[model samples]
Target: MSWQIWFVYGLVALAVLLFFSGRVRLDLTAALVIIALAVSGILTPAEAVSGFGNPLVMLIAGLFIVSEGLARTGVASAVGVKIAALGGRSERRLILLLMPVVAVLSAVMSSTGVVALFVPVVLTLAREAGLPPARLLMPLAIAALIGGMLTLIGTPPNLVVNRALIDAGRDGFAFFDFTLIGGCILLLAIGFLLTLGMRLLPQRTSAPSDDRHRRLHEFAEHYGIGDQLRSLRIQAESALVGKTVGEAAMRREHGLTVIALQRGRWLSSLNPVLVNTRLQADDVLIVVGRPETIATQTTDLRLSDQGFPHGLQRRYRESFGAAETLVVPGSPLVGKTLAQANLRARQRINVLAMRRADKPLEIDFQDTQLQSGDLLLVAGSWSDLERLTGPRTDMVLLQMPAELADRTWHANQAPWAVLITLLMLFAMATQVTSNLVAVMLAAFFMVVTRCVEMNEAYRSMNWQSLVLIAGMLPLADALAKTGGADQIVNGLSALFAGHGVYVILVGLFLLTSLLSQFISNTATTVLIAPIALNLALGLGYSPQAFMMTVAIAASTAFATPVASPVNILVLAPGQYRFSDFVKVGVPLQMLALAVTVLLVPLVFPLTRT
Candidate 1:
């Protein structure tokens, strides 16, 4: 290899490390890699930029826009809400309903898209059904992973590998070609999840493992604005010592939406409106809604700083307009009452809301408190706020308001939209039309018919993944062109030379599984597809079988957030620790590995050497 290639290799290694470390954003890491490749002359500026416009890359981007359109129309979220209602009372029934639905959607759309849309829904449904979120989110993520493996255009990784194989002069596997083995593996994994997987999850871990999230400390800081959540002694003049939330509401007529009633530390969401539920002194009412609304209705209600939006600008002058603020740990207002913070007056901004890592705010607006990792929704000119968060070492602004695209999805023509989208996917699968053409037409139709607005369509696409794919595709091509693929194939073929083709098949599956955890499925597919073809050539085995193995393995990212974007999304809502994934995921991974290993060799047997 030349010095340039060596340098490229070093950059690639560093990029991979940073990707798994989760320190920097993935999009930035991908951008840096492309920049390094361009500077190192591994790719010309034209070649480096060409990946952005690649048809496959464009297809992925377009699909994201389509997914965004669906989201805007409330179609996807509506589907989730409807599914939750249908699951009925039984947990098994719920799994049966959600798993297959997620799986099928994943097969047609992006897994990340499916997860983003459904993770919240699943969390909400689980809490409503009174089941732990840990029981459902793993299955949801895994099903999405498996569903993508079922078809050619199902997942970005599958598409990347399929296209890479075709680009390398081998005919790509058909859309449904992976379905038999993939379906078997998916069914088996789902069964394990429903039967044994739920038992392994940390049942009701210290955090609210249910999707409702409502953590006590965070809620107290962010939403508990007033004496709605009082921990007070029965003073000589106090009026609520024995009066319940219902009694106070009926008498005081305050617009208090009680999230929960806590008496002597016992919390209950039941009978929130019943005035007869006797309340003792020092009992807390975790309420929701506006502070002024609460105070005007209730008597002697001293406002506290429970929901005094943390992580927003604490001190904003007029110059702090349209900028960003970061929330640092151990700041002056870390645990202080919002009233004490004088957030509205001193900061000259409105504390809109706060999002905590562990739970959703449950208490009424009058009584929440701020906590660490609380993303405070503040309304102010960004330039007016000073940098209390820190320069480089403290809690940083993870996202800015302007950077957040408005995802106000609206589904105007729901039936026609879904029908046309399905037809397009079907055409792509059946070979009646190319995916590139079919999806493009679908997008065009969506625009011309006003099913989705042009700006909304443009805004919906996942530009990050599109850019990453575009950058990596050329590098993947270079790896094949540089004889890097052949080197890898030779090593693999030799290692499994003595063993039967089954061992080689199993090895490929495991290798792809590991690579997928570190890099994206799309990157894994693009890089591994060429090598799999070479391995088949070396062993005089079926190239189709090797390709299928690579395709299947790349889609099964069940182990960690580092494995898939969908996993990262549910991590917070599922209230899952890193270990929670492994505890449940390892078994499913092993099952998928075993099933694919056995089934692929049987279905597409290797020729006798």
Candidate 2:
């Protein structure tokens, strides 16, 4: 091997370590790879930097915008709501229905995004369906992984393989090219889970768990804050729909405190709440009052229960009512007056009383300026109260009284959201243009169709993932340009010499699958696909066979919680440990492997040439 190949190998090794170490981010590590390759003369400056302009990068960016459109329009959430409604308290039937819905959504949208939409819905559904959350959450995450297999744009790895074909001077795969193999695998997965996977799911644990982390009413009891915490939606027909907190006189007329108003479809700190912030239709108010008073006010005000279907009467008694939380040094709520901070409107907690530096503020608590050491008596769901003490926010939950329930806003556009998603899918499947052009067009339609706004489209793009992919592409280029890919291919050929092509196929599958367990799947694919491509070419077999193996393997991030973001998202909510994944995912991984090894050759044909 030449000096350039040796240098590229060393550089690639260093980059892989940096990726595994988690000290530096994956995107930054990718940029470092680009710098090392260019400085070592492994590639020209333009060659090292060429990945930014790759068509795959544009396709990924455009796809992010398209996904943002579907989310912003509420299409995915709408599907979740419908499916959850059908869950009907039967675990078997719920899994049967829920898994397929999540998979189909993941097939069209980002798998990670699908997981995000489903987690809360799963939490709510688990409560209604009388199942432990852990049982439902793991399946939801797994189904999302399977969903990515069903379409070309289903996941980034699928796109990587198709791009490998195009870069190798072959026709890129059309959309739905993955459907036959991926679909069959998905069906088998569903069946496998229904049969064997049912017994593998976890039951609720009893390790003195935090009650605040449990179901809504349980969380309320854990915090001693019961019916005082309630959610009300300002409907169009309600008298308070267009009124501001101060104008509505909730405190004077009804003895109620408006904690937080979940106003607008999107919110940020830049959009601050004030006393004059008017309530709009569908706005959810986290308010505090006694059961009878709140009920009387809601009846007269004509407010909807804000999607909180839990029976307050059932959990009413046995209350410490509300508790005081101390504000330690450096909370966001510090320094602002009760009127200025608008804790009710801003953080969605009612500040009933305050004691500054151990001295009670018996009078004028509302207008008094907050200090660093203020102890605040607040009321709301345990969940909202817990947020104040979170590492990201200010104020500790006092570890006692805090709980939360699922909340909703702005669901009226759900039909439009679904319609826009279908249109986007149609464009991609038909190849209305190149995948990149179609995505960009669908994204534009999402904006012009009012499914999403310009700013939201901009915000929804996962720039980090995009940069990570773009940065890693240059490393792939360096390998091929420096003869490094050929060397790697030669090594694999020597190991598998005189063996049937299926040997190399399974080898690549295991290699890619295992690497994805630890590293980013897309990164694994970018590095391995080029090698697999060259290896197939060297052995005089169809590269498509090998490329397909790599693609399926890359999506096999089922062995660890860290394998994929989809897994991590469910870890806390599902109360899962690292070993839980191995226990549940290993068998599923084997199923995917058995299916892939047997079916890929039949579909792509190792001897097609």
Report the C-alpha lDDT of model 2 over 1-609, residue by residue, as the tens digit: 888888877886786566555577666776887787778777788887887898766765665565555444444434445665676777888888988888898888767656755675676567556667888889899999989888888998999999999999966777887787778777887787788888887776312254444444553443344456777877789888778777987876766777555655332111223468787887777666667777888888877765334332212111112445777677776777776776666665666656665665545466666777787776554445556665655666554432223322223444655565566556654546565665567667767767667787787665655665666677666666777766765576578666778788778888788767755788778878888888878788788878888888888788766577677667656766556677778888888888888988888777645
User: What does candidate 1 score on TM?
Assistant: 0.54
lDDT minimum window of 10 residues, candidate 2: 312-321
**N/CA/C clash count, model 1:** 49
Q: Pick the candidate with the highest lDDT.
A: 2
- For model 2, give the RMSD to the true fold: 9.5
The TM-score measured for candidate 2 stands at 0.56
lDDT of 1 at 522: 73
lDDT of 1 at 202: 62
Query: In every candidate, how many clashes are there?
Result: 49, 7
Error of 2 at 243 (Å): 14
TM-score to true structure, per model: 0.54, 0.56
